[model samples]
Target: MLLSVEKITKEFPIQKGLFGTPTAYLRAVAGVSFDIEAGEVVGLVGESGCGKSTVGRCVVGLHQATDGRVLWDGKDIAKLSPEERRTLRRRFQMVFQNPFSSLNPRQKIEDVLLEPIAVHGLFRPSERAAAVQELIEQVGLSSKDLQKYPHEFSGGQRQRIGIARALACQPDLMVLDEPVSSLDVSVQASILNLLTKLNRDRKIGYLFISHDLQVVGYISTRVLVMYLGVVVEEGRVDQVLKSPRHPYTQTLLKASLGASVAVKGEQLSPAQVVPGCAFYNRCPHAESRCSNEKQDFQEVDGVWRVACWKWHKIG
Candidate 1:
């Protein structure tokens, strides 16, 4: 495995005092596990605030998990020393959801691309300009834009620059959190195509996180559907989307097709942590057992996994 999320869980404490006393903990991601191999795209699909971005951050070491391990190349990043992480930084990188906020407004495009190389000693100062030019051309941007700042570019161009900045590190794995969500629908295709080309030509593995199932269906070989921090369904993109086993997955697909899948399961409290499946309260096919026992992942057809107790009975 190029990257492995080994039962990763992250929680944020609700502070009640200035000294960081916790009154309660908000579970952002709960026991999530997945793997990404070289030159593969693993798509993570969920609604907004479903802990998609949090999982991405944990993979890249932006936030240490409250529990569990993020293993990259057989090593747990949470256990790595700060210096060790810095040394291995080039091996993994991230493209944030918001391009404008991620890039520095004051820095020129050339400086933005070259600075990481300079800091990591990937290239000498004399050779940095040549590396920057090469990356710019690779991302379908001109070398002339190198003199411009982040604010000067349009939204799509800024995103191209953001991608170029990530490529500057020469990373082997990239966690792109909604890389094209912020752009125009027309422009989204070009960025998606660029990402596909990068993955093809550079042999880089990707953890592609997005709320759009259509985009995920088009780009991913495998898809993992997340709901309230837990993966309810996982399978090949075509299989899961075309014949979703989980009720939540069905609802999503139906909604996308302009059909309403009424979500009238039960009244659910966001703060309540249940022992059973997180989607149980909202699962149209939920059973009585689903209220008491947490559904464990089970193989249905050797290629797909489902966490719903009544997955076989659904549809």
Candidate 2:
């Protein structure tokens, strides 16, 4: 496996009052597990604060997993020593959701791109300039933009720079957290195309996190639906998108199609921590079983898996 996440959980303690001790735990990612093969793109789809970004961070070693293991090439990343983890950093990289915030405003594009190479000692001082120039061209940025600071560029351009910097380490796996969500529709396509091209040419595996189902459907081979820090559904993109088995997945599709206009009650708050199924309260077809009993993932087909009790009944 290129990457394997086995029962990985991340919990954040909620502090109450001014001198509050931890009162409650917000389970961001609760026992999530999946695997990605080499050169494959796995899309992680969910509403905001569903812990998709947190899971991505855990996989890339940004946040140490609160439970279970994140095995990359048969090694648990959480167990790696500081030096070992630093060495393993070159094997995986991440592109953040916000391009503007990810880059330094004062640093020139070239410096930002070259910093990874310098830190990893990948290139000599004399060769670093040429390497930076090559990276700029690889990401479809012009060498002329090398001297420009991040604020001088448009949002799309800044994202392109982020992509270039992530690629500087020649990473085998990339966790892209809403890479195109911040750009214009027109620019989003261009960035997606660039990512697609990079995957094909470089054979880099991707864990793409996004709430935009349409974008995920366009690029991902497989889709994993997350809710309340748990994966409710996982399947091939077409299978899941066209015929979603979970009620939450169906609701998400409906929301994507702008069906929220017809819904009568108050919209479900995405941030609220749910008890059983994260989507149970919002699901139109939700039953008492949904609210009381936690669902477990079960295979319906060779390629599809869902965690809903009513999945068998739903076509």
Candidate 3:
């Protein structure tokens, strides 16, 4: 496995005051497990606040998981030495949701892309300029724009720069957290195509996180549906999107397709840790067992898995 997330969980402590100790914790990601092979694209789909971004952050080392392990190449990342960690950092990169916020307003585009190369020592001074030109060109940008700051570009152009910045590391995998959500529809399509081309030419694995099912469907080979920090359903892209087993997954598909599905339960809060299935209240097919008994991940055909005991009845 290129990357393996073994039941990784991340929780944020909710403090009573600025200086006080935490009174409670908000579980942002709860025991989510998945693996990504080299060159595979796995889409993580969910509604807003469903912990999609949190999962991406955990994968890229932006957040230290409160529990469990994040393994890269069969080695636990948390256990790596400082030098080893620095070396490992070059193998994976992340592109944030907001391009403008992620880029520095003070620095020129060349400096932004050059930082990673300088840190990693990927190229000597004589070779660095050519490397930066290649990186910018690979993302469909001109070498002339390298002299400009981030704010001078349009939203789509800024996103291309963000992608170029990530590519500067020559990573094997990328964790793209809604890379195109902030752009116009026309701009979104161009970014998506650029990403597809990058994957095809470079064979970079991707963990694409998004709330939009259509966007996920367009770019992913396999998809995992998350709800309140738990993966409710997981399968091939066509299998999950066309024939979703979990009620929550079904509801998402309906919503994406402009078909309305009534939410049957009360609003759920991630802070309120449920003993049973997280989607119990919201699931129309939820049983009494779903309210009290924890749902184990059950395999359907050895390829698909769901965390709902009532999936069969719902299907």
| Model 2 lDDT tens row, 66-109 | 89999988889877788887888897999998998999888999
**Cα lDDT of all candidates, in order?**
0.88, 0.88, 0.91
Off by over 4 Å in 3: 17-19, 265-267
Error of 3 at 246 (Å): 0.4
Please list the residue runs of candidate 1 whose C-alpha ends up more than 4 Å from where it truly belongs after superposition.
17-19, 265-270
* Predicted structure with the largest lDDT when compared to the true one: 3
Error of 2 at 60 (Å): 0.9
Error of 2 at 163 (Å): 0.3
TM-score per candidate, chains pooled: 0.96, 0.94, 0.97
lDDT of 1 by residue, 1-315 (tens): 889999999998865776768888788889999989988899999887688889999999999999999988878997778788787778899999998899999999999998888878898778888999999999999999999989889888989998998999999999999999999999999999999999999999899999988899899999999888889899898789989998888988887778877787543443568888787777766778888898889887766898887888885
Kindly list the per-residue Cα lDDT of model 3 for residues 1-315, writing each as its tens digit: 999999999999875666687888999999999999999999999878889999999998999999999998888999999999999989989999999899999999999999999999999989999999999998899999999999999999999999999999999999999998999999999999999999999999999999999999999999999999999899898888888888888899998999889777554888998999888888788778889898888997566898888778888
Ranking 1 against 3 by lDDT, winner: 3
Which 10 consecutive positions of candidate 2 have the poorest summed lDDT? 261-270
Q: Judged by lDDT against the true structure, how good is candidate 1?
A: 0.88
